[model samples]
Target: MPNDSPELNHEVTAPRAGTAREWELFVSEDATESPRHVGSVTAPTREAALERAELHVGRDAATLWLCPADEVTRRTAETAALSNR
Candidate 1:
């Protein structure tokens, strides 16, 4: 369970004028049957995000996915639904 915090200060101007940002975390296989989420300290670099993920996975080889913030929720839902069946 690592804390994921990314410091991004970028603004977007358009029809939906707002701040454009992303939070990076790692999706790794859990030691137990249950799924666990671990986040790293806020980093503005992709390298930092990948580093965080590697830390969680430890020495094991893993498939890492750098999903967008919006996709996070969707993917979670899909996983949950499939697992529940």
Candidate 2:
């Protein structure tokens, strides 16, 4: 009998050894506003990403969000225009 399990069907993946991961930083100035991408940082872990972000852009930010660059999708107007052709 074939075992059918959703959890078992998924493959786990991790960054390669000694590779630095890029993290995107977002900052919001106040509670009423949404966070905007300010810059990116390359680090080995989330903690290090936060420290880098704080040093660069988090000093006056009301909130900060750090997301792995690979996990975020971005498309710019220039790219969009090119794709239309």
Candidate 3:
């Protein structure tokens, strides 16, 4: 089956909060499957972020989502909940 997701094709622009920010990149080749996190990119703008991510991880993506790294929850192997358990 093809992706029935709503189009999110609008141009994406990052907020100019600082010089540059790290954006976490996720790509979906099969929409029925959750998008995979290919890698991260540091860019001054969302357009730049998309460009960088595309350059790095192209062909495998049908849809992409860019999220600020600062906003994403992070847990190192040492500090992860598994460590406490």
Candidate 4:
């Protein structure tokens, strides 16, 4: 682990399935108590994906787990349909 912290806003982009997206991890002092700023990640398996993302961001902070690709597609469609009204 890196003892010295770098500036925030660090991010990494890589391939996923076919499309590409950005994944980042960082520390947030504002978090309730401990450092918690594990950024977002997208992958087939949430666990593995988050792990990879955490490594990229290089900080031990809270995380927002992402759902599977199919679930995201379904939810997006549902939200689009609802907003079409």
Candidate 5:
């Protein structure tokens, strides 16, 4: 059987007052295509993030996905090399 596993990284932190948290925006123009990372937004809350995303890119997207930047674990090629050591 194939291993059906989901990537897990659930750590989320609250944004401080007067500070904004980064949100990753993914949008799909149509149902046939997968959502692609378009850009990012800085907001104090999830609701604000969605609002900003909609204003900027959601108007033409069929679907939208907003992910907290803190929740994402990004690894660059250089970092990947170091991790393999």
Candidate 6:
């Protein structure tokens, strides 16, 4: 059976109750390079988040940083400041 005439749809939902907080992990392999976002961890507390981050994303990393996703501020292309061209 070949069924190729269908639409694929996806929906995003908010975090659940017990595990409500999400922490983003930043991975740095060298001192000369700035850390970059590697992955995310969902946990009820920061300690668990840190542990999860270290186990998941920091296995081979030099350093890892975990911050609450809600506390972190980000600037997208739409909200970023424009420089003189």
lDDT of candidate 4 over 1-85, digit per residue (tens): 6545466444333345465443434454345655443445655455667677657655544434444434333245545776676
Ranking by lDDT: 2, 5, 3, 6, 4, 1
Best by TM-score: 6
> What TM-score, computed on C-alpha atoms, does each candidate reach?
0.35, 0.66, 0.61, 0.31, 0.66, 0.72
Q: What is the C-alpha RMSD of each candidate to the true structure, in Å?
A: 9.6, 14.3, 14.2, 11.2, 11.9, 5.7
Candidate 2 lDDT over 2-22, as tens digits, reads: 668998776445544458888
List the candidate 2 regions with Cα displacement exceeding 4 Å.
1-18, 76-85
Question: Clashes in model 1: which pairs?
Answer: 3-39, 4-39, 4-40, 5-42, 6-42
Best by lDDT: 2
- For residues 16-70, could you state the per-residue lDDT of candidate 6 as single tens digits? 4554698989989977778999988889899988889988974678888899988
Alpha carbon lDDT of each predicted model: 0.49, 0.85, 0.81, 0.50, 0.84, 0.80
Query: Could you tell me which 10 consecutive residues in candidate 4 have the lowest summed lDDT?
Result: 65-74
Query: Cα deviation of 39 in candidate 2 (Å)?
Result: 0.3
Candidate 4 lDDT (Cα, 0 to 1): 0.50
Which residue pairs clash in candidate 3? none
Q: Which pairs clash inside model 4? A: 36-62, 37-62
Q: Which pairs, if any, clash in model 5? A: none
Off by over 4 Å in 1: 1-41, 75-85
- The clash tally of candidate 1 reads 5
Error of 2 at 84 (Å): 13
Tens digit of lDDT per residue, candidate 3, span 1-85?
6665567644345654568988999888977878888888889888999899889887877788889888887677766767666
Model 6 clashing residue pairs (backbone): none
Worst 10 residues of 5 by lDDT: 3-12
Model 4 residue-pair collision total: 2
